[model samples]
Target: MKLVVAYIRHEAFEPIRLELLELGFPSITIIEVKGSGRQKGITEQYRGSALTNYLRPKIKIECVVADGDTQTIVDTILKHARTGSIGDGKVFVIPVEQAYRIRTGESGEETLQIHPDAAAAAT
Candidate 1:
């Protein structure tokens, strides 16, 4: 299995989620995060004061899929998340040693599949 982690602009979350769902990759975990990379954060003016080195808000989307689906998922995220500018964010693919569905004790690839039948069986 592979875990695809994508850090994307906050505004891109909904579009990315919808695209992923259309692609049959509906199982995702989203986290609101703040960080900066090559863009090195940004400067903003508040109350006539300059706020420097402020971490930008980003959405982190994590989806674990069978190894074969990793690239497709990554592409979907990139397509939906890109804005032709810096701070557009990045995606990382990590190898998952194992995964377990706590209820049914399903492990490995089965743990990542999202299906009504499978979910019911897991309980």
Candidate 2:
């Protein structure tokens, strides 16, 4: 298994979420975060004074998927999150040595996807 983590421009989250869903990746964790990257934040004017905020707001999207699904998931994030500019954010693929679905006590790849029965029930 692998964990795909992406810190994306906040505006990019919605579209990214939709595409990932269309690609059959329905389970992901979303976190509102703030960080600095190569772009290093922006300077703005307030009360005629320049203010520089070093931390920019971002949306953190995390998903654990089967090993074979890693690249496709990363591509989906890249396709939607790229703005062709700095601070479009970063995507990291990390090794997931294990996973366990707490509610169902399921482990391995079985814990990564919404079971067919559970999905149908939600619909």
RMSD per prediction, one decimal? 2.6, 1.2
Question: In candidate 1, what are the lDDT values of residues 10-106, reduced to their tens digit?
Answer: 8889988898888888899999999978888578889999888758889999999998999899888998888899999999999999999998788
- Candidate 2 has an lDDT of 0.92
lDDT of 2 at 106: 90
Off by over 4 Å in 2: none
Q: Could you tell me the lDDT of residue 48 within candidate 1?
A: 100
How accurate locally, in lDDT, is each candidate? 0.89, 0.92
Give the clash count for model 2: 0
Top model number, TM-score: 2
